[model samples]
Target: MSADTDMEALMDMTRDQLHAAATRYYKKRGPTEPDVALIEYGAARAVFKDYGRAPGWFNRLIAPVLLWREASALAALDDLAGVPRLYRRVDARGLLIEHCPATAWPQARAGDIAYQRLDALVTAMHERGVAHGDLRGGGNILVDDQDRPYLVDFVSRIRRGRPWNLPWNWIFGQLAAADRSALAKLRVRHARHLATADDYERHRPSTGFARFARSVGQRIRRGVRFFGARS
Candidate 1:
């Protein structure tokens, strides 16, 4: 079967074929984590996060849980523009995702419209009940040649609560605000000349939950996963 050269190409190749043909990789922390690999076929480009390559014990005990988290987030944010598409799930240990063709936020030379578009994208993501929880760091964002924004890396996302879940819903609000605050800070960083008073206000110190999330959420998550694996 021949898939089109567009996003359909992302689903054409099987997992093993893509893995063997991966041209490059990013963020492969340890034997305990997954390998973020780039797979490029004729007209298809994608990223495969393969926890299958992690140690047997780690892969069996913990990888599935993290993989599930990312997959869940991607599923929840499906069809959202800034978020990447989830191509396919490769067993319980890995998943395929769209390879965003854009420059990293830190390195991007974007203008006010790009920043405005980024803010709207974040707002749309929040409306879908997911908080990035890490956009403040800037590594997760990307900008295309047209200066459009893209948010990547769903591993750190925090999901919102149901209607009856008041406490957790409130927490989601704080974390979502953190995402906005992060964006405002980024706008000032990349194009300060266009930064407005509202941007400065939103960039102020975040709520406690948001603050903890932005500051040490990854460390705490890693620690939890490590300890959970031991138990």
Candidate 2:
């Protein structure tokens, strides 16, 4: 087949098949972990340099598949509230995410505010026919200048109607030990975001909050994949 024909055939492959092919390609290249590289995203995908850090063994073990899968999943839910913006695929290893420079949070304790926004965002996401497979405290949440919390990762958003094999609390309560104020702020933000329990009730299976979440989740997934890919 001609080169164009070969490329066309590859485009028809399933995500799994493409992944397997990419895996084989990388393994032969003597893969290394990311080098703390900050990806400048604006396309669908981008090649990112991974930062070498401690716990190399662990990251190396799961980085390849996890990174790709996480980013792809988040892309699927880019409409969720707090989910980061996405443009187009730049490459297999990099994504063109909406660039939001580092800005201040809405409230005093940025961490706390971020955590609070995360809580609301997650709740809103759940209501909108999706679940964040991982809502851990550390890297999955960010706060905007207005103290608006954004959920950054979504390597694992499943349809609400689908069956989940993990524990709800384990997945949702990843930041249970984070500062109490942050958590509280998140809860308040969610309640406020929904505009009241009545709003939550009205949107119970598809809340409006997911609109923002979709973007936040995308960014989180992108960052995770970028960090985890090199190994």
Candidate 3:
């Protein structure tokens, strides 16, 4: 990490200033995802997700759609705890997001409270009509110094449908279950002791139909992700 971009230097700068000042990046190796940067200005910091830098048509057309989708999810979840705050849209191609000060879950050592909190957070998120379709991947969870859990990367989220929409509502149910199963998967990986007999029984291998639903859910997720990335 380089020195923080100073406040004085940023005073007269536009939206692009902080992006230009970003000193570190993550996942620059990936071709499919957006460019993520850690932008700092004095003590203020943020994560910038910019698809403007993506290559080819994905940059011009697909990126903004994906950016808007994620931004909408953030807005829907704006008041929810344990999720990053949306600062503002940088442009059609990017977003400025609040920085969660935490270690990635895969690297961070956390107590059972973290898992518990994560479960609650996921539940709260669902109650607000969002299902995070990709938590099983683990890269999107974070644990901070005080053991609170944080969820990031809302690009693949699915919203609950209106009551009159049966099919969409059913899809939402399956995705919501997937979210719960994802939390169970987390326990299996990072805190197996936390999984009780009931947890094992309830979340045991998904039934054939459940498996089908999960597959459908993931397909929808990938469809959304790619559509946004490819837009």
Candidate 4:
């Protein structure tokens, strides 16, 4: 079948049908713990992410929540440019998202326009009360064929509300700041002439809590992935 026909057929399928097809045909991509896969539906390619059986106590406890969090974040993003369109939630543990045909931010010295686009995208996300908490990771920021920036992996996103309230607000604020700082650093490195004074100002050092959170997150990811590999 043609790609378009394939995609339409896949989309037309019932949830159970889609799930079965994905199980049978999806090709595993990234690390196994989260079990990311490149799935070909009717005519389209999608990313299937399953965080159900993560290794380690901390990971197992949090994996389902993170999976839902990411799905919620993507739903909020909806049709915004630079944000992938979420297809469906395969189960409690999995989501199928639009496959971005893009490369990491490090692939090119993306000009000022790309940085501006990224800033605008980030602003839109914040306006909707979502913060991309882990923008420092190169893999999460993608540059498309036209050089527009697309952010992926919303598992670490900070949503607006209680739990995200009070002292948590302080941490969330730092995370938001870090996102801006990361963009600023990118502009400085790839498009120096376009770097604004504000960008430079926002690029200050990460707070202690931000540092600690990042460290803990890294350790968890490493531990879970290592356990997964061993298994």
The best candidate by TM-score is: 1
Residue-pair clashes per candidate, as listed? 0, 52, 2, 5
After best superposition, candidate 1 residue 121: deviation in angstroms? 0.4
lDDT of 4 by residue, 1-231 (tens): 788788777556554555456633333433345666666665677777766444455345556776788899999999688898888876676687898877789775566677779989998888787888777746689987787889998877877667536877666666677777778877766677888998776555556666665444455567756765665
Give Cα-based local distance difference scores for all models: 0.80, 0.43, 0.77, 0.71
Question: At residue 53, what lDDT does model 1 achieve?
Answer: 69
Candidate 1, poorest ten consecutive residues by summed lDDT? 1-10
**Candidate achieving higher lDDT, 2 or 3:** 3
RMSD of 3: 3.8
Q: How would you encode candidate 1's per-residue C-alpha lDDT over 1-231 as one tens digit per residue?
A: 343654465666666776777888877746666788888776677889988867657678778887888899999999898789888997898899888888788888887798889988999999998988777768889999998889987777789888999988877887787787888888777788877888898787756655765644476567856774564
lDDT of 3 by residue, 1-231 (tens): 233444334444455676677888865613346778888776667788877666766567666776887899999999987899888787897788878989888889889888889989999999999988767667888999899999998776889989999988887888788778777777777788998765666565477767766555457556655765544
In model 3, pairs of residues that clash are 61-231, 62-231
Error of 3 at 127 (Å): 0.5
lDDT of 2 by residue, 1-231 (tens): 465554444434443333333311211221233322223212212222221232454345554454566466566567775776654343444333443333323333464445546666666665565566444233445566666666554454544433454554333333222222233333444435424454334232234433234234445556655654544
Segments of candidate 3 deviating more than 4 angstroms = 1-16, 29-31, 201-209, 215-231
TM-score of each: 0.86, 0.42, 0.85, 0.76
